[model samples]
Every structure is written in structure tokens, then in C-alpha cells.
Target: MRRSLPVDAAPPVAVGRGEAYENMRCDVCGSGERDEELLLCDGCDRGRHIFCLRPIAARVPTGPWFCPACAPRSKPVKRFPMTQTKIIDFFRIQKGAEDVEAEKCGIFQDVKKRRKRPLVMHKKRRRILPYVPTEDKVQRLKQMASLATAMTSATMKFSNELTYMPGMAGRSSNQARLEEGGMQILPKEDKETIELCRTMQKRGECPPLLVVFDSREGFTVQADADIKDMTFIAEYTGDVDFLENRVNDDCDSIMTLLLTEDPSKRLVICPDKRGNISRFINGINNHTLDGKKKQNIKCVRYDIDGESHVLLVACRDIACGEKLYYDYNGYEHEYPTHHFI
Candidate 1:
């Protein structure tokens, strides 16, 4: 017989091949070899297909001898979640949970957060008023302010009283003269000036609008204009005694219009003898001006005594129930007048 292998020593199992009959460890779950039907796994060297080994091995490929645990894990995972998606979803869920927790706390946190936010608003400034006098009583504070407007300008023509003859062309000519000579309602630049004044007044500072009018037109008197020999005629009321004081002290003779109540229920003030300069301060008071029909006009007059006092005229005619323009001088403006819903 050919030289036989020794009983004690069959060829030593190659280190790479593993010992003969020494079962290969299962790659799946590291379970020890239990089945030997499938030949050694190429990867794990176990004697069974990987499907037989681990909990998830049923999902792994069979036939190819691979450790069951290893096979399932090695299969390419499908449907991996995107990083951004995962993060957003996680945060959303976290927020929901927190909301639930907040609800359980018995305090309405959402409502509380809303309430905690302060109601903020933008408030337009109220113009500071020329002091309402408590002493000397002039009248027609509103009319005075308008008459003192620097923007209203007029051109006057010298015509004798004969020119005012009623029913004569003289009267018509006088009418034309009045139209041309008397203060022609000057185009008002007041909106801009008022806006600027409001901006300044907001800071608790007084900013006056100084304007210059051409006296060549009608007798022009601005708020800051100098007064010399002008006679100011204003209307009056025995009622509202408090107003008398304001006129005496706070009213400036040059800048104020005297208010007078007439039987017609209208307030009339005259800057000069010429009716052209008469200011209807209390048109609204008498219902000559309807406040409901238009909101811009109102009856307001500050009474004071002086030849220089100018009657304030309404930019628009007025009616009753309108807010008087007495406070046109200037007032304090507060920030955030209202809260946003």
C-alpha cells in the first residue's frame, strides 16, 4: 500500500482552512454552529445558510451560506431618512410634546404669551395749544389761529366807500376788489408745516411755524409777524367764563382772534374794519358749519384784546359737531398710540 497518513497526524489542518470537523462559527448573531446542511459560509465559514441563524435572517438571502445576522445587516438598507427631514420632524414632534406638557401645566401659555406682549402703537402728536388764558378774555381762538396762518395771502386795492354802493357796478367793482384785494385764500403749505411741527412736538419740544406774507396783498398777519397799529375786532360770549381768563393771559394780541357770539348763533371776529377779514370762529357753534357734513371745520376762538389780533379763518367752512381747531398751536405726541391686533 502507498504510504498511509498517520492516524495521529492526518495532514495538519491548514491555518487558513480551519481544523477539519471544527465547525465554523455562525456570522449571524455569532450563534454557534447548529446546522450543517449548507456548506461552510464563504464569509462566515458557518455550515448553514445565513437565513437559519439570526432573528432577522428570514429577510436575508438564502442558498449562499452567510451568517444570518450578518446577511440581514449587510443587505442595503432602503428608504433612509433625509437628515433635514429627520431633524424637522423631530423638532415638530418635540414642539407638539412640549405643547401638550404646557397644556397639562394648567396655565394657558399660548394665551399668556400673547398677553405678555405689550400693545404698542404709533400715536400722532397732538399740537400744543397757545395757553388757554385764565385772565384777559379775548375770543375766537380758532379764528385767530387761522388768521395768523402765514400761508394765507391776499392782494388789496384802495377803493373808497363809494365803491361799495349796493346794486351799483361800484358794488360789483368792490366785490371784485374784495376778491382781488382781500386775503385771497393762499394755497396752504400747512400740511407739510403741520407735519414738521408734529414731528418736533413729539419730543416734548415746541417748534413754531414761522411764515412771511406779502402785506402788499391784503393785510397779512402771520403767527410771528410784528403788529403796529392794527385794530382787532373779535366776537364775545358772556357764557363760558373760564374762557375770559384764557384770553386775558394766554392770547397774544397779534396772534389771537376775539370771539363774539351773534344772534345768528355764528361766531364772528374781525381783524380790521373791512368785513373781508372777518373770521367765523364759531360757525359750527351756530350750525352755519355742519360738522357731520365735513369734519375739517370747527368753531374755536381764543379771545384777547388788541389792535393786532388776527382772526383765524377756517381752511374749509365748518358746521356744528366738528372738532374745533383751537389746539392747532402744538401738543405732546406719545409713541405707540395703539396696540396691533
Candidate 2:
């Protein structure tokens, strides 16, 4: 038969931090002690030491039980794998140092003291140094400007003389003669260099668009959409804050979709297969977008993930040959994980 404890009845063996543990004295074994021992609970929160309880060990299951005297100990939780362990250790050490420093200062007390002083130094007697202008001599300045103007006129005349028709705009037979005299203008074309320049111009510092397929048979396409071609059109997208902060991580928070005008009446769906569509979208909005929905826009395509899902974008309607894109957001990410393809 199952049993339930009386609501008003005291527990058989309470072994942690609670009103019963707090009020009940450690010395009296029923009355609580005035100076409760500070102990960390299994969850790493503030807890009371062990020796305060009546029986000293817990049999009660309902309450958060941690001995006030000593930190509650449970079997160590499994740790991350070796690579992750190293990363954790590195960060933990750095954080531990910060904690130690913070404890010493006693929570912004040092900050207050440091902040009391003026950030910029003030001078009692502000001495004025006499300014010596570069163009103090009017005649010299005029002479220099006249020389510059004359030189520019001469160069323009020479350049006009060198101008040629379509295929050979800047190239001239005189270029080889000038090269021997240690002068070089535009470089001779190398096929590899020309191709590299073209690639760089096309990519334009915008990251390559990533399309991940969990299963091999997932439908994928590389095509841009005109306004009419897009089933669902979300205009004016991308996070201003993300751009401002230079955060380019895959998991970075983004601007929420401000307007969800389903012109095509396409069903807005979530990537999560198990949860309700609205709830999943809410979760993605709140956590991923940082809850700011402004001019940023996004579109949802039902079958993209083999489930209903939304895709984020950049503002402009891409050209026919352009790559499809999604914002790869991140918040305080590590190096290797945030690597570009």
C-alpha cells in the first residue's frame, strides 16, 4: 500500500535546510540554533550545516535537505568528455580567480572607491601654449598650392595623352620602359589572381550561407527569389544590434521577425516536431532572438526540416543566382565552434 505523510506532522528524519531544520535548535535537538553553519547544498546554493538535525541524516524525501554545518555531498555528477573538460577547466580557473577577487573586494565596494575619483585629471592652472601654424607664412602657402596645382595639371595632360580605346584602356607600350625605370602601374593579369579577385568581390565579407541536412535525402536547392516567387515574403530583416556588436556566432541572438504577413497563407511552423508550433516559435523567439521584434523579418517554410520551420534572412531580395542565407547567431562563443566553413 502507498503512504502519505500528514501535512501538519513533522518529518521522521529531516536532514536539510528547511523551516523545521531552521527553527528547531541543534543543541536542544528540537529548537533551531542561532548561528547556523553555512554549507553549500548539492545544487551549489546556500545551505545549512549537517549537525543541526535531530537524527543527523535524512529519511525525508520531499524537502531540499542539506546540512547547514557542512556542504551536502552526493556522488559527483558525470563530467564532459576530455576536450570539453579541458575547456571547462580553463574557464573555471579564470572564473575562480574572478570570484576570489570579488569576494576580497566585497561586491562593488572597490568599484565604488575607484569610481569616486575623477576619470580625467584636472589642472589647477590651465596653461595656454602659443599655437604655431604650419601655414604662418602666407606667401609660402600660396607658392606650395600653386606648385601642386601646376603639377596636377601636368599629370592630367600626360594621363590624357596615354588614354586609349576599349580593350587597352590603361596599358601602353611605354609601361615596359617605365617598369625598367622602377615604376609600376596596373599589374599584368594572372588567371589565378583574376579568379581570386572575382571570388572576393562576390563574397563581399558576408559569410557563406550554411544549409545543414540531418538526413541524406533532405531536399535542398540553391536559388534566389523575386518578390512574387517567394511563397512567404518577410521584408527588412537582420539584427541591428548583432551588427552593432560584431557578434557573428551561429547561436547569437538575432532581431525577431517584426511582421509575419503570410501573403501566400503559408502555415508558420516550428522546427520542433514534438511541441506545439506556436510554443516552439515562442521559445525560438524568446531565446534565439533575444525577444526584440522590430523591422527584422523572417519567413517560414513548412517542409524545410521535414517539419514546419521558419528561416531568418538578410533584408534585400536576393538575385536569381545568389546564395540562400540564414543568420548564424552566437552569444559569447568559443573559437573552434564558431569557425567559418
Candidate 3:
């Protein structure tokens, strides 16, 4: 079902740049035309036009109106899990591929000629080569539980990181994207942040982060210490698949991966089955008061070697105990926040 649109086909919806409208628009219909009838949700503060509501209302309510999902005592009706493995077998991972770790860590061009080396060949780095995870068993389990909780509402298997199923892109094929002009090498500035993250992952050094359950947001990630701006937090790991195929996919945590000029080559990351803390990080309802301020973590994409990796970086200095939030729709404003957790 998922395949890229032909080049001559109708234009697709914009994916990035989720900018809200100038006037408060209806969250249900995504329109600002009917100004007077639009009512703001008391809970999330998103506007909803009266006509968009079921059984169309004649006039706006008095004071403190809430959406159906945000109504008092209203409960979330969770749906069946989208765990069918057979439905995603349209793509296949390239065979005899390079190991994934090397693809993630390696980004150097081969040197044809060698220069004379100094007697002391040692090099220096700001952070250690590999990050070491805390040895505490309780903390490790806590991290695992956070990942597990991402899909707990729908009953899904837990994954600490992204997993490549048989039909997903293989390391070698992903690496070939550079030659095909579909991806670029991580810039020097971008490389530093990602390298730090990789070192932490290599040494199993867990970030000073934790996943905590929020009655309103299901599960959310938080900073355990004061984190600096541009500090790499975690990569959005998941099953990489074509976007066209997932048009009807029931997974809620799917993220856009690579969007190339060629419509047939679009890719998306489905984290329902396997992902880390990034999967648990909730999206900001931009219509709320904290919608803009609540986003402490900025999601960034990088092309390391030939593979694409999505990283969650702090947009600014984060104090201890602050929860993390980001714009799920990037800049497009397409992803909806209609269903409250």
C-alpha cells in the first residue's frame, strides 16, 4: 500500500515546518474560517469550531468548555496493537551488508597518501571515547521500562534501540545513499554532537535522563541533571520503512525519516516495536500555553556515512527535573493533537 507518489502525480502534503496559523484555528477541522463558533479546549487550550463537533452545535457554550477527549471522566479508548510483522515485508534489507555499528560510527574519507607522524601519536577528545552506563541494576531496569511503556498502552514488544527487520533498509544500502546523492555527510559541527552520543552509546553510558509516566501524556522523558544546549540526548531509533506503504499503518509513533526529491524513495521510521527513550517523548500540543515553551528538546536529523539518524538535541540549557517535549510534525503542522493521552 505504501509507495512513493510518481513525480507527475499530485503534490503531497508538506512534512516539515509545523507552523500554527495566525488566528486560533479549529483543531478538529484545521480551519480558521469560522471564527465565532470556535471554542477553546479548557484542558489543552486548542480551539475547536462548533460545526466540527458531533451533532453540530448552534452556539458556543458559556464558559470552560472541553473537547470530548478532554472532557472530565472521559477515558481513552485504546485500539488493537499494529504488531502484524507480515504486513511490512514489501521492502528487503540488502544482503552481505556492513555491520550497523561501523555505518553509524564511521564517516571518514580514505587517505590515498600518508603523512609523517609525530613521535607521540596520541590524540585528545573533549569527552571520553566510550560512555559507560551506570552499573546500578535498578536504573538499568528503569530505562528499559521507559522504552517498554512507549507501546504499553497498545501492548507492544520493547526495544532499547532501532532494529532492522528483514524488509528494512540494510546498512550497506543505506550507506550507498551518499553516492546516489540522496544523503550528505554529517557536517563538522553536527558530527561533534552525534559523536558524543555515539561514544556514550558505545560505552553504555546512559544519559542523565529518565522516563516517567504522566497522567496526561502517557509517558514522557525528563532531564535528571542540568543539560547544556546542543547536548546529544538520544537517537530516534525504529524500523526504517517506506512512507507510501504505511499510509494506513495504525502505529501512532511513526516518524518521518528521509524525504528525497524522488517521490518513490521516501522513508519513514516506525518505532512501535523497537525504540529507545525518544519514542516515549511526547509531542507538544502547540495550541496550549506551554506548546512552544514545553519543547526543550529539538529533534535533528543527520546523515552519518550513508545512514540517516534522527537525534534529539537540547535546544537550550535544561534544568534538572524538567520534562522534555518536541514538535512531532516538525514544521508542517500536519500531525494532529486531537486525541489527548
Candidate maximizing TM-score = 3
Q: Each model's C-alpha lDDT?
A: 0.26, 0.26, 0.58
The C-alpha TM-scores of every prediction are 0.16, 0.17, 0.55
- Model 3 — TM-score against the truth? 0.55
**In angstroms, how far off is 329's CA in candidate 1?**
20
Each model's total of backbone clashes: 52, 24, 14
Candidate 1 per-residue lDDT over residues 12-48, each given as its tens digit = 3457555543555444345554443233543644454
Cα displacement (angstroms), candidate 2, residue 135, comes to 45
Instruction: Give the lDDT ranking, best first.
Output: 3, 1, 2
Regions of candidate 3 where Cα sits further than 4 Å from its true position: 1-162, 168-184, 188-193, 338-341
lDDT string, candidate 2, 160-272, tens digits: 01122342212222122222222222222222222232232122211122111212211112222232222222222221111222222222123221112322211111111
RMSD of each: 43.0, 31.0, 12.6
Total clashes in model 1, counting residue pairs 3 or more apart in sequence or in different chains = 52
> Order of candidates by TM-score, top first?
3, 2, 1
Top-lDDT candidate index: 3
